[model samples]
Target chain A: MKKHRTSPTTDSRYKPARPFNADEFGRVRRILGGKVLFVQGDAAVAYGALLAGCRFFAGYPITPATETSEILSQLMPRVGGVCIQMEDEIASVGAIIGASRAGVKSMTATSGPGFSLMQENIGYAAMTETPCVIVDVQRSGPSTGQPTEGAQGDIMQAKWGSHGDYELIALSPSTVQECLDLTIEAFNLSETYGIPVILLTDGIIGHMREKVVLPEFEEIELTWRREPTKPKEEFQPFLVDSTKIPEMAIFGTGYHTYITGLTHSETGYPATDSQVDHHRLVQRLCDKIRDNRDRIVQVERDYSDGDKDTIGIVSYGVTSRSVNSAVKMLRQDGLKIDHLRLVTNWPFPEKEVAELSERANRIVVPELNLGQVYHGVREAVAGRSEVIPLWKTGGEMHVPHDIVELVKGGVK
Target chain B: MIVRFAGFGGQGIVVSSYIIGKSAVLDGKKAIQNQAYGSESRGGECRGDVVIANEEIYELEPTNYDVLVAMTQPAYEAFVPLLKPGGTLILDSDLVVTDKKLEPKKIKKHAIPATDIAFKKFGRKIVANMIILGYMNTLLSPVSESALEKAISESVPKGTEKMNLEAMREGIRLAREGKG
Candidate 1:
């Protein structure tokens, strides 16, 4: 029998420091003074999460979103953080929520089916007011419709996936660079509002490779949840301060805090049956985001010199790319048109949409799903302008010619 | 510049476009690369599209290719129509046989025996992608030759750098001599 020697590398518990040179990890590079990197959007999110001081990641592997976890698994350890591959999506979100409560930034990523599994725990995080980031890389699904294809079918689901009347922040990123930038913003928003921020991306943006210029480490902005200013005895975890957001007490800091999914009072005690208390609690939760809509919503707009013939196009995520190209092609033909690309999907920019509706002769909404955001556009426009929806499904993205032709037909 | 690379799944079709896109980025240009393919791991038709520009690239997918790199017959047949008028077409002469009568008018064509050269010179067909990249560099100048070579050395698998570089150099020589 041949003698087998066990190398140190054979030990499963032993992780090599700096597994490869920084240059070898094509996923990201910050050396040589801000050089560009060609990386997938998923990898960019992972880098963004790392840069935003996210110290804990618990994720269950799923298609399209798995790369995010894989990159984080390799990176978190190198940065003195921890990444766990949980048993299921529920446990994944649960673990991150726990980590967040322990005074660390945490996150979880999943696709449509896995996101479905995480809904209840996401609600738990919401009720407890834990700050954590959840990434839903949307794919075709009512229930596991297409595993490997791309779709923006979860725009509404991101807002209402959990039960109850609560508000959360959802951002849609179209480019690889935006994937990095918006993920940092998502974490900041979550930390700022004490709500779970959703980085809602599609399979195309999640899996596609593009050139990204990563900001320097010192240039990145990071925010943390507001901590209690009062003493441990007087600290109220759910008290609505003047900021409309409650301050959180760390779990092991000698503060007596009660955290529950039940409707709770300002002192963090469960008030299961009191309607007035329930009303106040839920209203505060919703109002924290609602009152700050001006600061929360981000939209990119381009107008066509007040041309009467110009139409307004509203799009987000991958569909925004096609809409942009279509607008350019139409403009080359002297057909005036403008576009509003929604970077923040939820806390919908109704005011901006209404303004565009008032200006343009017609408003065109294009998306990968069958008229999800279009409904919101129509509601915002409210018969002021014709809201035409160009919807496509079944994993194929809208070609530029199709969108341009639709606009042309409308113009005619 | 919008470029498309198409071939069978195992031809490193995605990697070729990826390296080119990375090269452009290293040269301080914006580039985006997207790919589509069937479920099969090796035999399915694979295609990749890359766009490089001085400004931000808003179009995620290419509408009309400025350059088309077709490494197989099926790829040439499928993508030739999508090439812009007067665009450049790069072909693997050993794999793609063009019908002159059916070819699009006014488009410049540069055909090279990239696969044959990779197999004959380096004894590995996988390096054909690097050869095509080298040939493409001579035609389009999408990125500098040094930038592409740097991207290749960083992208390919370990220990195969020598063979891949040799293949690329051979391709550049063929293009320079008008031997393809």
Candidate 2:
């Protein structure tokens, strides 16, 4: 075995760059804008990250998700950003966390197997309250089941994969345009809440090419983590503020903050033994997201008529496209139906789901997986409406005709 | 409009749909293109699907194709049934032989020897897909001529624009004269 250097500067090969200025941001927009580029979903995500001001990327390539890292590797250096292909998925996520803590937006993209490897670090980021993004271009898997086939099997994994109780934000994109737009939203949400945001796409969307009209930089809204306003001596890294979020202190900014995964007090020292400290830290972690759930969750609703007899269909990602088309055809046939598409998957959108269930006589959920989100829909409806699941798991999308047939027959 | 290009792998089937999708976008229409292929690297059946619409596309994949471009006999047999009634069917006359007795009567058929045209006229067999695309351009003008030309130039290899254009024009000429 070769002996490796252990020094901080030598052990880690890439140093995090400073935040991008207006000129650098302008260059990124120019590189991405001006024309409707017919590009793959993975390329759109890479460009979206650059436009969202991500200056650091660390990832280990996996099938279906490799294009994201490949494009970033070529483009990051051109725009004064850094892309590092780490040794493993754990190291890839760890490096991005380190970069985020250094006051730069950072990200990593991977598939199911790589995502499984990154869970420990994902939990670590949550414990440390680091702001970063992770893109999981999902593939069929329990353990590398299919490398190239698309599946929504990771829907539940994305929310509950990491151990311990914590809140997560996940957004699913159906189109290549949404892949770009939602990626930018993922970065913004991560920065706003100081949490790890996951853009849960799948193999089909990752590999498919579509027409994407990117907006000008001036029209796009961007948000960054708020800097600490307190003086160096008064800085408390873990203190909950009026907004229920702690302002972050940059590592090299002379704030002298201690960062660790252990349960800690407001002063940032490890308090692994104290029950009250652990309780406080955990509660803040969950509450920061739960208290602001109204502002964080996004769902698109379309109703044929505001009537209680309609059959409501709930879906997300690529499956939603089939559902939308099915609903349109059913409506043309004089059937009453509607659709509720989940844009933000995590935090569950429990309230919206419950309200829709109350108005809907029956709710149908079609997913690429066996029945992941169906369980959530069943629970949220709570017997107010009959919940049905239309599942397909053979690495194929549900055709609209099949869905139309199901809706016509109604739930058994 | 939903169109499908089907052939064995390595026939540029996927790229043909990609060019159509790119041209649709250039024409200010919403478009999406996706593909399905077998695990084999080459010679396996492959299909590419494109959906172009004046409004936002709700269905990512077409349930029934409005136009079908069949470049191989197997592909032609497999996809011809999925073509909508009265839809246009473009086939490579040299590779796919349609059964007139059993074939649907309502469809409009345009059979062109795309491979022969490419090899005989452009001195390359690989440009057959471009030739087929050029032939389809006449039957269904889903995108403008200029937009299709720009999309072709952007999609093909860096230094082969001139030869590909020649192949495409030859295909257009065959379609204009109703020649197979």
Candidate 3:
């Protein structure tokens, strides 16, 4: 296993993003210094991306996610960064990948309909090992089911939307502050793993306004992808060390780098005819993330007194907020229950869910969709506990009373 | 405290909830504000919700509102029953006539000609929401007056803050004189 670094690390050879004016930076810091900002989750994501050193944004306007691009368009020009309204979602993702290849931290924000259109390029970014961020503010969907309403309907599509077996990282935020904090985390993780990371927020959280206090700029940790150390004459863009992550050589850096969506060899050239080369390339793409699962996966667990079997609630995104409130109501009624909230949903956090199953007699998985993460939890439990799913759709969030009533009724 | 503001889309119904939520946060309380998004075009029925608490608020949308401010009859008829028992209801007397059958009898109800006052005093009917917001805040005291004024000044459109603040003060005077 690779040694985990606690603080963000940037390769010494990598060039840092251009700094904005001192007066402007200080003004932002002062405004956010202990002052509670009542801002929508979409605006919070834009601020987070700006703080994360993301200098380029290319996105088409979509409900629940349009505010992010709108805010970025106003702020990015002030920081001397670029923000463009792409022709469509495909072009938006394509532009970000091109920007990333040029060595700039780039991102795009869109809803489910746009997300579906970007899947091909998302896969292209994964295969080419380009780092970028994609913000999917999920609305009720299955072909524009409800554009403005919130839903967790895209849980499975997020992981398998692209046609591939590549490992991906997706982080879900339940609160407006997390929309800001986790966007930065998504960028850092994307850089660290050389993969496109998804900030999977929903319309409910995306449009809701709440209090947020931004930390001082100096306190924020940021990670930059490792740069190639070898001279231009000797550099192999696809070569890797024991870490299995290749050192990225930015375009126009005098390094002869070749990138393609096709399976390639260590020299960064297509080796489509050889099964061995394909296997080696694909395995490293997947293993680079899987091997670092311990570092990438994060979850929050609540409840003490794990000595006996209790009711366990598993949830993610905005649905987790309902779970939190329900658990409090249940505990007040003298019910023994635990809660596990998934902050990083892509890697699945199977071990944590499995452990919760051991401590609880029955697990309740409440989601905005008809049962997506519930299936994953059931498989992770593997019969150690009974898995019950509370499925809700049509975009209204699960109220605390819904979960409380279900638990009180003792219905499967 | 949970409050809902209901009116036509262009009546600043959502902005009223946002201002109160910001004022609560300024007063050192946690607050969350949300609004019904779609079908909120001008002249369409709209509603905005706000929840203020000293602790972390887990509920995103409250089913029952402690206070409901209705500026139109349709809005009043649609959301009156959602007011909790013994809750307060503030209505625009010029626009909404209450139906006794639809409202909770135990609830406290107050009427003010907010739109008429805004049109007469401020010459802009859009400022009516500010008057209603001030009246509601005075009756409930959900946030400090200083915080509410600051939030109002910051939240209203630039150059219109003075007029909006004046309208709000007029509302405060009305409530003090037992007119609301």
Candidate 4:
């Protein structure tokens, strides 16, 4: 997080004229010159991490997501950061937590099986209030079902795979540009709330290549973890007021910070048996995100101009692209349809979906898996509108023709 | 326009489509490039698709193609049927044996022995994709020649750029001469 740090450049004499890091960031800006870069979604995530001031990355290589780590391994050192290929996904998550504890922005990328292995540590990160980013480029799974194909089966696992009932932030990106933009936002939200943020991308979006313009350096905004203002002797690691987010003291900052996975009080020590302390600790861990949902949750409402005759479609990730194309086709045929694209999948956009239900006669949920997000949408709709599930699996995305046909039939 | 490049994994099918997508963007158009293949690195059936548009491309994956470039027999058989009516089909003549009975009416077909030409001229069959790209661009003009040349120069292996650009020019010459 050092703004004054110098980039390791080949030419020692050539220093950056601008204030930003020159070696990598300046070269990227100069070369691209606001031109579109044709790159895979995975590469965009890696670029997003570097732009967001993430200096530490640790991950086990997996298909679809391996490209993210691969690109970062080459780019991280150029920006004077450490990128480690850990032996396993569990160790990968552990390493990032340690790095974030040391006060450097950290991240890890993985796919389904690897993501499953990181669940315990994810819970630990939440309990320890570590600010780190985990990218899960999803694949067909229950196990290693299909390594190369994309699926949205892990939407539920992202929020509930861990043992505890704690809440976290998860974002879903449908396009390559969003892959870059949302990943940067993931780190910002993680640091802002002191939580482990999950970036839920899929194999399709991760593997696909598209043209995207990298944001100029001046346009980028980074969020760093809040530091304790008190002196080292008087600092309490978990102390907080109305914000419900503690100020983190770096590991070597001479502060007596005791971080543990066990439920702790404001002083950051074990309180394993005290029920009141455990409830208070867990409630704040979940409340910090829940109370800030208005600031956190983002939902894109498309064609809201659709009248009462329009059918409402709710989707996220790669599946949402099909919904977008399908809505266009249906609208062309003089059919009205509204789309709710959930950019923030976890703090499910219940209020917005309920609002959409009130406007439309029926709602459709299209997902890559069989009814993961559909159930959540139904619960949110609360029978205000009929919720229909259009599920497809086996790696291929739902085609726009299929969505059009389904919605067209609903019109009848 | 939606174009598809179909071949085995080692034939540079994916990179060829990527070059077109990049060239289109360089020419100030929007494009998306995507592919489907087995886990194997080589000798497996593969297909890469690119969608280009002046406006935003809502279709992430296309079901049919406006143009098809088939580099192998299986690839031709698997994808040619998906070509839109009145679309164009290009194939490597030495590799794919076309059946007039199965070919759709009102469709233009161009058969170039790209692999043989690559081996004869460039001494490398891997540059066939560049040749097909040149021929396709000459016929369709989806992207400018300068953009295509720049994309190939930036995309190919460092030392191979000169040979790839030469191969592309040969295809362009062939198209101009109406030889393939």
- Winner on lDDT between 1 and 2 is 2
Residue pairs with clashing backbones, model 3? none
Task: Select the stronger candidate by lDDT from 1 and 3.
Answer: 3
For every model shown, the clashing-pair count is 0, 0, 0, 0
Which candidate has the highest DockQ of all? 3
DockQ (0 to 1) for model 2: 0.68
lDDT of 2 by residue, A81-164 (tens): 899999999999999999999888999999999999999989988888899999999998888888988989998988899988
Model 3: CA > 4 A from native = A1-34, B37-40
Q: Tens digits of per-residue lDDT for model 4 on A1-412?
A: 0112111111222122123453556665553335569999999899888887788999999997999999888877877789999999999999999999998899999999999999999999999999999999999998999999999999999999899779898999989999998888898888888889999999999999988788876666557787877998889999997889888888997999999999898999998899999999999998988887877888877754635766889989888888878887888897778888888988888887888888877888889998898988889889889888898999888888888888877441
Q: What is model 4's native contact fraction? A: 0.81
**Native contacts kept, each candidate:** 0.69, 0.81, 0.86, 0.81
The residue-level lDDT of candidate 1 at A389 comes to: 89
lDDT by residue for model 3 over A1-412, one digit each (tens)? 1112122233333343334444654565553344468999998899888877788999999997999999888888877789999999999999999999998999999999999999999999999999999999999888877888999988888889999779889989999999998998898888878899999999999999998877565756667888888898989989999888888989998998999999898788888999899888889989988887878788877754744678888889999888889988898898987888888888888988888887888888999998899999999999999888999999888989889988776574
* lDDT assessment of candidate 4: 0.87
Residue A320 in candidate 1, Cα distance off native in Å? 1.8
Q: For each candidate, give its TM-score against the true structure.
A: 0.89, 0.92, 0.95, 0.94
Candidate 1 C-alpha error for residue A112, in Å: 1.8
lDDT of 4 by residue, B87-146 (tens): 999999999999876666677999999999999998999999989999999999999999
Residue B138 CA displacement from its true place in model 1, Å: 0.9
Candidate 1 residues lying further than 4 Å off, grouped into runs, are A1-34, A307-310, B38-44, B73-77, B80-87, B96-109
Name the lDDT value of residue A78 in candidate 4: 72
- Interface DockQ of candidate 1: 0.53
lDDT of each: 0.84, 0.86, 0.87, 0.87
